[model samples]
Structures are given as C-alpha cells and as structure tokens.
Target: MAGVIVDTRGLARSEQNGRGSAEPEAALPDSDRPELGGALEALSGEILKKRSLEISSTSFVTIISIILGVALALLAEKTFPFPRPLVAAQSACMLLLFVCTFYYFLSISIILRWAPSFADCAQPFIITSLEIPPTYFLGRVTGWDACLAILFVFVAAGVGSTVMWSPVSHFGGDRKAQRMLHRIFREVAVIFGTGALSLASIGLAAHFAQAGKMWWGFGSCAVVLATLGALVARMEIQLSRIHAYYGVNRPPFN
Candidate 1:
C-alpha cells in the first residue's frame, strides 16, 4: 500500500530556502502553515499506536495458536498415531502454521526497528518536543537480540519445511524472486492458518474418539477457531480503513 509518508526532509528543505527564519505561525503563507506540521506529527503518532496494537494482537493470537496446537498434536500422537492418515496431515499443517507465525513477527519487528527514524521524522513538527536520542528501539537493545531473532525465524522456517517437505515450494528462490509472496503473508496466514485450525479440529475429534467421546474435544477447537476468525476479520477491517484513509491503492502484488 502506498502510504502518505510525510517527507519531512523535503518539507524542511522547502521551509528553509523558501521562507527565511522562524517566525510566528500566522506570518507564514496559507499554503505553508506551521500548524499543519503539528497535525501531521499527531497523525503519525496515532498511526504508530494503531500499528503497535496490531502487533500485540497478532502476537497474542500466535501464542494461543501454538499452545492449543501443541496440545492437540500431543493428544493425536498418543491416541491416533501410526496408521492414521491425520498424523501426517496435522504435522504438515503445524509446520506451515509455524512458518507463517515466524514471518509475521519478523515483519512487525523489522518495521518497528525503523521506529526511531520515524520518531526523528516527527521531531521538528512538534512545538515542544523532548530531545530524543536517535537510537530508540522501543525500549533497549539487549546483547544478542538481533542474532537470536534471526535464528528464531530461520529455525522455525527450517523445521516447518522439514515437516511439510514440498510446502511453499513455489516461493523457493532468491529474495527478489520471493518478493510477491512476501507481500501476501497476512493473506496466506489467514487462509492457510484457517486450514491449520481445521486440521487441529479434526485431530481433536480423533483424540476424543479414544475415550468414546469423539465430539467433546471438537467443541473447544471450534471456539478457538471462532475467536481466531473474529480476530482476522478485525484486522482486515483495520487494513481496509487504513487504505481508505490514506487513499492508498495497493496493487495485487503489493
């Protein structure tokens, strides 16, 4: 999506060469009102807050997915291993699900790493801003954090691929080749992630069969899937509103 990145650098250059020194807001031409700077800064802050919430919500969903997913896998493995075909299917789905979650967090984290730059981009616009150091990472930078994060993403993808074998084989190539696939991670996660839930639901039903209560475990999974569906719907609505607000027309590839 083409967002309205307030080119503060360009705007500052224009303000400097075109209009000589700082003066009262009222003194500037209507086209170059100082108040607009503050307004844009405020909007940027609001957008960042919204993005942070999106990150948190997605993280929470992934956590719940992993926990319930693990439980479902264990239940199925103990009760319905070997000859059952679902053992193979559940294992594959879980692997892909992990891959999607890894990429999802990595995408958000990389975007957040640029937040300090974004804060600097907001600086001059604020009338009474604090002198912030240019090195903010939302909090602090722990030693080995970057290394651990990179390792985490790759490890998840590696294990997931090992399980699924030919899963996502279409997107295997250099970075440039995978650009189109990268853009649609959210869509993939929602669609295939739903598929993952279905596998888990079936596995749950199979597990409860050993106890002669085949449908009991499915009830819990159904609730979990419903909650996840609601979360995805909310995220889609948020994206649609953001695109509408920014007049951003994302091409199919992007």
Candidate 2:
C-alpha cells in the first residue's frame, strides 16, 4: 500500500508547453538551471571519464568470470566422464553470480541510506493524465504484497546487472582513478537506487498466495541471474556508444 504521485520535472516541461511558451525550458541556457548540474557539454565530459573508470572496474569482473569459466571447461575436460567436477563447476558459477549480486545489493543499500525517499514526499508520481486521481485513497488495495515481492525481484535483477560485469576492487585503484571511479559508481548507484526505491514503493506483477509464493520465489532468483547476463551484453553496447561519443581511443581513457 506504498505509493506516491509523480508531478515534478517529469511533467514540469509539459506544463510549460500548455502555456504556449514553445518549450522554453529546452531553449533556456544551462546556466538558467543551476539545480540541473550545469552545462550539458561539461557534464558529458565528466560522464565520459567516470564511465571509463567504471568500465575498467567492470572489466575486472568480466576477465575473472571468463577465466573461471574457461578453467571450469578445462577441468571438465580433464575430469572427462566424472559428474562431480561438472557439478562443482556449475555450483561455483552460481556462487560467483550470487556473490556478485549480493555485493551489488550492498552497494545499493549504501546509497539508499543517504538518498532521500521518493515515497510520501513532495516528489510523488503524478497521475492526472491517466485519470487515476493523484489524490485517490489507495490503502491496501489487495494484492499489494505480491506486487511488492515481484518489484523487489526486478530491482534485484536491475542492480545485479550493474555489478554482474563490474566488481569493485583495488585493481585500478590509483589515487585519482580510484576517487573518480568511486564518484562515477556513486552517481550510477544513486540513480539506480532511487529507481529501485520508486518501483518497490509502487510494486509489480500480480498476487501470489500459499504454496505458489514458493514457486515464484525460485523463479525470481533465476530471473535475477538471467537479467544480469542480458544486462552485461547491453552494457557493452552502451559502453561502445559512450566511447564513440567521447572519440574511441586507447583503453584506460583518461
């Protein structure tokens, strides 16, 4: 039964248009909105640097995952007809994914601790366009619990994806790179964390009851891992686009 109305910057632009200003917000210079973190061009430069450092940290997880996978394959070959080694390899992979997911969850929690809640605040989800009445009384409208469970699962998957490819460690922990990468990760973490919070408050899917909840629980776990693999692929594409924007050059882009 947790929810909020969304009626801030998400709709502020539309309000300006209705007044026949021809979207002046877009035309206004970056200096006009100091609250928006200033100039887009400068922001892009910083974004590039931060994302590069993130990519390097992300690379560590990628390299380690690949090496582990290859080693398992070779071990399986050596074991040949032995089922135990194959089973062990599978278990290890699962353990690695789970550990990474758990770490990602921890990182998110750290951000949430400092980030303000979007629920029951001035920044609620506006629903005037949907005719649902932003001020409608929506207390415990049944099935809310199930919706929350599903949302937690999805958020888990989303955050897990962020870290499945990027493990945080000291491999590239030079003084400046470390500080910059941490800052970049912090920003990404906050955005992702806020999103997760908003979704969790609103909830997802349908209601599950009795023994069915157990089945849904297992399914959610599988979804988290699968989502991580899929997101990693998408992350590569995103990194390529960012690199192209910043001018693709040598690795360790400073």
Candidate 3:
C-alpha cells in the first residue's frame, strides 16, 4: 500500500515554476528590433533643416549685394556732376541693368527646375553686372525725361521680349528657348518694378530740390537703395526656395 504515493504538491510547484519562466520571456523588452526606416526618416529631416538654413543665408547675401550696388550708384551720383548726355547714358545703363536682373531671376528659377548646369554662370553675371549697375545709374540720373524714357524702354523691352520669345511656334525653339523665357519674365518684372521705384525716387528728388533739402535727395537715394535691396532679397528668397525644393546647396550657404 505504500508503494505508489503521488506527490501532487510537488507536481503543482513544478507547473507554476514553468509558467513563471514563460511570463518573463513574454515581458522582455523589444529594444533590439531594427528601425532602419525610422533612422532614414530622421536623417532626411536633418538634411532638409540644413538646406533651409543654407537657403536663408544665401538670401541674406543677395540682399547685401543689392544694397552695396545701390549705395555705389548713389555715391557716384552725389560725387560726380553728370551732363545731359551722361544722364542719358546712365538711364540706358539702368534699363540694361533692370533687364539683366529680371532675366537672372527668371533664369535661376528655370535652372532650378530644368537646367542646373547653366545657373552658376548666369546667376553671378546677372547679380553683379545687370541688377546693380543700372539701378545705381537710374538713381543718379536727375532728368525727368530721361527717367520717363528709360521706364518706357524697359516696359517696351519687357512686352516685346515676352511676346517674341513666348513658347509659341512663331518663336522657333532652339536649345536656348527656356533661357529666353527666363529672360523675358525677369525683364518684365524688372521693368515694372524699376519704373515704379524710379518714379518714387524722382518725386522725392524733386521735393528735395524745391525745398533745398539736401537730405531729401539722400532720402530719395535711400529709397532707391531700399528698393534694390528688396528686389535682390526677393530674388534670393525665390532662389533659396528653388534650391530647397531641388535639394541643392547654394553658395554662401553650403
């Protein structure tokens, strides 16, 4: 009768121990699981942040360039006495500069989307040569007729260029068709913007001349400077956005 004694308590204890072991396995932390996709997403976000900062910096530089250019022109005006012919020359120069700046901006925008390779060459040329010098001269030239004529020419160039170079079959497509369009739009904007700015400057200049208020002339110059700065700033911002969208690095920002 003592041969088959069942240890039911010991069997229950063993089963409980097995259950406890399985509970720990189920509760283990999943820290070691791969998150490659999450890491990539975070990396991409960092890149975008950097790019945005870079773009902002480039925009600042462009603003500065505009300021410097305008200042130079104003300084020249105050220091030198321009004759009627010189005034005419200055107006033409201003017109050219306005056209150039416009073309530069339009080109940069197009380059951002289509042809990046040409941007480097075109942008600097537009900024240094086209946008700055003409604006400077325009501010310096004092004749009303000169200013009006320049404005008229700018408007005419804008309209004519746009029509001539539009994506129509009348304008045959060559390799530089896109470039032409860019030039057309930029010139148009510049013509309008510069004309408005010049009118304001002229009014201020006249007020200063009538009142013998030298400061008024300076104020007019300042206005021109500010307008130029704003123009460049706007263009830079546009360029920055383009760079950001394309995920490219612009100079002074990279």
- State the C-alpha lDDT per candidate: 0.39, 0.39, 0.49
Q: Quote the lDDT for 254 in model 2.
A: 29
- Cα TM-score per model: 0.26, 0.25, 0.35
> Where does candidate 1 stray beyond 4 Å?
1-111, 114-213, 250-254
* Candidate 3 weakest ten by summed lDDT: 108-117
Which window of 10 residues has the lowest lDDT sum in candidate 2? 126-135
Residue-wise C-alpha lDDT for candidate 3, range 118-214, written one tens digit per residue? 4333434433442333434443435432343344345445444544334544224443544444553575466456655665656556645655433
lDDT accuracy of residue 125 in candidate 3? 41
Give RMSD to native, each candidate. 23.7, 25.9, 15.6
Model 2 ranges off by over 4 Å = 1-208, 246-254
Tens digit per residue, CA lDDT, model 1, 46-144: 788676656654554455455445544553454343533333432333343344444444433332222234433332222011111101111112211
* Clash totals in order: 0, 6, 2
The global Cα lDDT (0 to 1) of model 1 is 0.39
> Model 2, residue 95: displacement in angstroms?
3.6
The number of the candidate with the highest lDDT is 3
Task: Provide the lDDT at 209 for model 1.
Answer: 56
